[model samples]
Target: MKTKRIILSALRSLGKNKLRSFLMMIGIIIGIIALTLIVSVGFGAKKQVMERVNKFGAESIMIRAGGGVQISQMSANQGTTTLKLADAEFLENIIPEIKGVAPFSSKGNTDIKYFEKSATVGLLGCTPSYAPVWDWNVTAGEFITDEDMKLLNRVCLIGTTVQKELFGDSYPIGEQIRIDNIQFEVKGILEPKGTSPGGGDMDNRVMIPLSTFMRRVANIDYLSAVKVLLHNPKEINTTAEKINQILRERHSLAEGEPDDFTLITPTEATEMAEKVSGTFNLFLALLAGLSLITGGFVIANIMTISVNERKKEIGLRKAVGASSKKIVLQFLFEALAITISGGVIGIVLGGAGAVILGIVMQIPVSVSWASILTGVISASIIGIVAGIQPAKKAARLNPIEALK
Candidate 1:
């Protein structure tokens, strides 16, 4: 009952000086907001990174040709022996762990024209299964079918940027676009994928059937890369080993000779993204921590001044038979109450700030309970510790001298 009375008295004293209490809470409020916003940004970045990694599909692998010795090394060899479409076909025929393979070649930064409207874009030649293998969604018309591949049809699917440049929001289906003087009909428009987290522009590419590209465009029997889709992602290492063995045998390469191709997994891409995000999160957390430390110092300063101001009151209570321990409890409880209130307000503001940033900045923001609890508990501890020095000073004051 006595402790309860002291707490109530402390709260009443704080209420009497409302503006001062509000001023004291300002530091804490700012600290909470900063911490919350930074942590939420970290989580948002992680989400974006993970989403990009998954865009390549969990079961996907890419095989690309590695550059060989220079032309000067051998007069007859210009370093052109590389992974071919036939190699991909052979793997498809033999490898049981491989679900499917799509051979693709691409060239970028070329001007394409459609009825006088022209734009510089990337052009890629790929098999029919490439679309589903990469998880690309078609917004209109249809993707290249087996019939298109068999006939070597000059049909293409355009990215969002190309569609806007050539067709300008109107339906681009049935339109024809000329790439490097070769005409192709627009069969579909890929759903807007925007820019990737790596800053690559996926929305500016034009995709065409591999057969058309081989016949009319590059005229090369070799392929730039092969996308290998696995049946199971967890068995990637084993699958890669088997693929290397097959490729070495097929190429007739001797021992200690490096394979002419590179095999990359989606898991490696995801790990790269995670490492980048982790560093960003650490930087943000450190920046926010500094602000929180400054806030804690401000809280300590205010509590100290508060102890000085309430010295006469403390003396009066002690003269009226209040114990030193009771005096300490009262001041400590008052500081705690003020801090708890500030902490609550800070959390609400911080969460609101995160949501507002997500909407306005066009970035995703997420707040977990762990972050909230950390902020609240840290602020409360700051208040309790900051108030101690002042509380002890107030408790040890000479009552007679305090009254004078």
Candidate 2:
């Protein structure tokens, strides 16, 4: 009954000064909207990044040679040569837990041409095992087979972007293309993979058999890295340890010698990305939260002025048997009602803005239940906290003096 009367009084007061009430909640509206948009964008980015990583087989680990170690053999008289095909084969034999191993080498800049179109693409050299390790989907034709690798076939599978650049509407399969002046047939086209958030152009690569790459392009029997597929992501640490032991022994490294290779898991990459995203979101949230705090102060100030203006009414009510508690409740309810209404409007407007931005920007937008609830609850709390002191002051006023 008291709650109903207080709410009714709050409604009447707000109705009497609609402009003033709206002005008081401006800060809160801005705060909620900004916070909602920031959170939605942050979570959307995280989800997209994880999806990309998952496509690469999250359980897989990449083992790459340390800096400046390109080849497998180094002589005292000659220069450095870091990774060899034999090393990869040896690791496979020694590490029983590894499901598969695909040693890869790459040429960063390769002029590729098909018909009248041309593009400079990253030429990846790997065995057929790479198809499984990388979880690549060949949309048309077929992936490189073990037999093709054994025979060192001069054939290539192009990324979707590469196909678009080189073939246009023409069927790429069996079409002849030139890579570094060497002729090769188009064996496959990879499924379209959207641009990575980290700016990796996954759709602009070309893959070829490792043997063909060594003989024709790089003219070297070495690899830059070895991708290993594990039976499960849970065995990441164990598999990493085993690979390290095998590589150390194979490289004939003595105790205390620095490792010449590094192993990285998808989880590590995901965690790093998440940390970056969290920091960015936190900075934005803080800025938005500051606006909310400022809005609370506005509400407090307005309520204070309201109490002064209504002093005569308050005095009359008190003289007519209104308790101090009832007066306090009335003012607090008014503040809360204004803030809660503002919160609702802010959420709806923010969501609409996010949807429009997502369409325009070509990015995902998400609104979680927790975020909506948090906004509503936080706004109400802000109103209550801001109004408390002023409400108490009004409640404690001397009715006789206030009537003056």
Candidate 3:
């Protein structure tokens, strides 16, 4: 009953000083907002990283032609001739860990036309191993066969986007289309994969046999990149290092000289992407920390003023036999009540902020109990830390002196 009175008295005091109560809670509200952003951003970043790693293939590695250049930094035309089909052949034969290798080249925005409809799309040159190496298969017809590679047949596989653009609701199988002035027959329809690691539409490309692409289309002997799959993903890094060493020896570069190729593993790509997002999250964490600290100070200052203003009230209550512990409890309760209320409001506003952020950045953001709990805990900690000194001050007051 005594504790209940203290709480009621605390609520009455807050009700009488509405503006001062709001002033104390403002800092907590802002701090909770920052904390909410941290949790939501964390959720979004993790999901995106997983999706990117899955798309890149966890059990595979890519050997891009350009040396010393990061996969994300390499341009379309930076193809180096040092990494050849021979290097791929050697890697296949020498590396026991490697399951398969698919050497391919690519060009973007190549025009493809059917009867009257036309669409420009990204083009890829792929071998038969491209299917199993990537675990990507056709939805309707067959992938590039060994016969297509041997004969350099002008045959192609169209992605769902291309199929929709050209064939529409009609069947795409056996449809003949012109890929940049060369007539190619569509042999298959690719599964509708959503987007690439680079954020391009994965369903917006055409796949042709590597031989045909190199000879009939572009007349290039060098491959743009090679995708390698592993029988055991646990050996990916070791295999990558082994392939790197052999390629260095085969290319005949000096002991210290860099090899004319870059090997990108799924783990490395995931780490790279996380580094970018992690740095951003770190910055937000700092801001949240700073805001909470500022909130604590704001709360403490207001609580001190509240203590001073209620000195006479405290003295009267003490004279009426209220204990010092009761005074402390009342002050603490007031601080906690305001903070809890502010935390709730901040969470709602922050969740809306996260949704807006997701729309603007084109990333997925989720609000869960984790976000709510984070906001509540953050606000509560600030409230307690800020309430302590003022609560102590109120408890230690000399009733007679305070009454004066």
Candidate 4:
């Protein structure tokens, strides 16, 4: 009952100076808002990456032409020609876990035309194993064959987006499309893959035999990447290490020399996501920490001033038999009330901010229970730490001198 009275007394004091109480809480509100945003964006972005990795194939690994570069290896945007089809074949022949290998090269934004209509799309040159390796079979007609790749045939497979853009509802299996002024017969329509992890449209490209792509289109003898489908996912790390050693020996790189090729597995994809999000989140955390510290100092200073100004009130309460312990609790409760209110407000706004960011950035964003719990705990801790000195000061005043 006495504790309830002290809490009520603290509320009443805050109500008398609403503006000052809000000022004390503003810093906490901002800090909690930033903290929640970091968690929401970080988790949501990581979820997006993991989802793509799952879709890409849990048992798959990719070897890109470049070691490391600014552009992502997933997008098939690497310009290096260090990786080759022979390297892919060599790995498959020796590695026991390898089920299939599909060496491929791609060129983004390739211009193609169908009669009067034309569109720009990704152009992929892949071997016959591409279908089984990717688990992505054509929905209609037939996929490329060894004969087509061997003869450097101009046969092609079109994705749904390309079909919709150039062919529209018309029967497209036997239709011809021109890529780089070279007409190719459409053998099949690829199943739609929707959006990629990096936000590119996966179903907006054309696939042809790698031989045709190298000799006729790009005029390159190198591969952009090699996709290896493993029989056992549990032994992936060992398999990847074996692949690395083989590639180094083939390339004739000395010890300690950087690898020309880069390996990307499901685990590496997740780590890539963590590194990206971790770096940005680290910066945000510092900002949030600074705001909380500033808010703590604000609370401490405002509260200390409030203690000095409320001398008459303290004196009257002590005269009326309010104990020193109750005096300490009352002031402490006031600070707690302000911070708790700020935290609630911050959480509500933070969730809304996350939604706004999702729409604006066109990426996933989610608020978790963990973020809310963190906000509540952070606010409470700041209030207790900031309130101690002021509460003790209010409690130690001489009743006679204070009343004067």
Candidate 5:
């Protein structure tokens, strides 16, 4: 009952100086807002990155020709030319966990023409198994076949972007298009794949037979990369190691020599994204923590000033038989009231701001209840820490000295 009275008295005292109370809460409000936004944005970015990584199929692996540091499966190679169709075939035969392999070569920014329209687009040469390996779908007609590869047929599949640029809405299947001055029939239209993880257009290319690419477009015997699909995604690391060993033996590399090719799995890609997101989140958390600490100092200063201003009140309460503990509790409750109120408001405002920012910036933002709870709890802790010294000072004041 005495505690209840102390709390009520604290509330009444705070109510008498609403502006000062609100000012004291400003730091806490800003800190909680920063913390909440950081958490929500970090979660959303991580989720988006994972989704993008998974789009390449979690059960798949990619082998690109070259050595040195490689961040993603899509990383292009220039130094090594050892990776070939034979290497892909050998790995598939040796690794029982391998489901399928699609060896492909690419020519970048080649001028392709149909009728009077022309566009510079990427030219990919892939085998019949490429569709199944990448889980790609043909919107119209059929993908590359063994017969086309065997005959080195001039049949190609155009992506939606190419189709739109060349044929517009008109059916492109069976239509003849000229790529690098070589005429080829459009056998199929690729389904839209939107954008790559690197923000490049996925559906802005053309795919032809691997044999045709080797003989005509790129004029290279070596493959650019090999897409490998695994029966079990969990065995990605083991399978990748096996593939590395096989490739090393085929290339006849001696002990301690750096690999001539790079192998990347979906798991690796996801881990990279996770690491990047974690770093970003840590940086954001540190900044927010600094803001919170600054806010704590503000609260502490305000509470100290309040203690000085209410010296007479403290003396009056002590003269009326109120215990020093009651005075301490009263000041602590007042600080908590200010911080808690600010935290609540900050949470609402922060969540709303995150959503608006996400929408405006076209970035993903997901607010969780855990983040909200953390903000409120952090505010409460800051309040307690900030009020402690002032509370103690107020409690220790002599009644006569305070009254004087």
Candidate 6:
């Protein structure tokens, strides 16, 4: 009953100066808002990144024609065309862990024309296994076949972006498009893949037979990269090592010579993405924490000021029958009321802001219950910590001295 009265007294005291109470809570509100936004955005980004990384299939591995270590997806050395079709065949035939192999060469920023319409797009030459290796499916018609490669057929598959650019609403299949003045029949339309992890448009390319590209366009036997799908994802490291040993022997690299090819596994790609996201989230979290600490200081200052200003009220309560413990409890309860109210308001505003930002920016935002609980608990802790000294001071004031 006495505790209830103390709580009511604290509420009444805060109500006396609504503006000051609101001002005291402003720091906590900002801190909680920052915390909620950072957590939600971080989670969304990590999820989106992981999804992008897994687009290549968790069991897949890529061997790019490069000498240096490949840290990022877009950093693979495109100039080094050491990888060959024969190398892909060799790996598939020799490595028991390999399920599928796709050897492909690419020429980017090439102009394609269908009558008056034209678009600059990427041109890829790949085998039929490329589709299965990359988990790509044709929305219509079919991908390149072994016969197409054997006969060096000038047939191509266009991505959705290229389809829209060149053909528009007209049926693209059975239509012919000229690449560098050479006409190739469109055999299929590829499903939309949106964007690559490197932020490139995945559905802005045209794919044709490897032989056709080699004979007509590139006029080179070397491949740009080879994608391999493993029987099991757990064997990626072992398979990569075996592939490295074979390639080193085939290339006749001496004991000290560096590898001519770079091996990139899906696991490595996912790890790299996770590491980047984790670092960013950590930085944001630290900034939010600093904001919260600053808010705590603001709260402490306000509470201290309140204690000084309410000295007479404290003395009056003590002159009656109120104990020192009750005085401390009253002040603590007031601090908690302010912080809790601020935290609730901040959470609602932050969540709404996150959703609005995501829609405007075309980014994903995921709000977890954990974030809400954390924000509330953090606010409560800050309030308690900030109010402790002031509460103690108020409790220890002599009735006569405080009254004077």
Clashes of each: 0, 5, 0, 0, 0, 0
lDDT of 3 by residue, 66-142 (tens): 77767554234445777778889999998899999988888888999998999999999999999888778999999
TM-score of every model versus the real structure:
0.81, 0.89, 0.95, 0.90, 0.88, 0.93
Clashing pairs in 5: none
TM-score of 2: 0.89
Error of 3 at 377 (Å): 1.2
Across 130-208, the per-residue lDDT of candidate 6 in tens digits comes to 8888889799998899899999999999999999888778898999899989999999999999988777898998999
The number of the candidate with the highest lDDT is: 4
Ranking by TM-score: 3, 6, 4, 2, 5, 1
Please state the error at residue 356 of candidate 4 in Å: 1.7
Judged by lDDT against the true structure, how good is candidate 4?
0.90
| Whole-model alpha-carbon lDDT for candidate 1 | 0.79
How well is each residue in 1-404 modelled by candidate 5, as lDDT tens digits? 28889889989999999999989888889889999998899878877787777777889888888886465445356456888889999888989999999998887778999979999998889999988888887989999999999999999999999988999889999999999999999999998998776556789989999999999777788988898999999988899899989899999999999998888777777788788888988998998889888888888898899899999999988998989898899989988998898899889888998999899998879899977998999999998998899999999999999999
Model 2 scores worst on lDDT over the 10 consecutive residues at 70-79
Q: What is the C-alpha RMSD of each candidate to the true structure, in Å?
A: 5.4, 4.4, 1.7, 2.5, 2.8, 2.1
Candidate 5 has an lDDT of 0.88
| lDDT scores in order | 0.79, 0.82, 0.88, 0.90, 0.88, 0.88
How many clashing residue pairs, candidate 3?
0
Which regions of candidate 1 fall more than 4 Å away from where they truly are? 1-8, 15-26, 65-81, 137-139, 192-197, 244-262, 319-326, 337-363, 367-371, 396-404
What is the TM-score of candidate 6? Answer: 0.93
lDDT of 3: 0.88
lDDT of 4 by residue, 279-391 (tens): 99899999998998899899999999999999999999998898899999998999899888988898889888988989998878879998899889999999998999999
Error (Å) of candidate 5 at residue 53 is 2.8
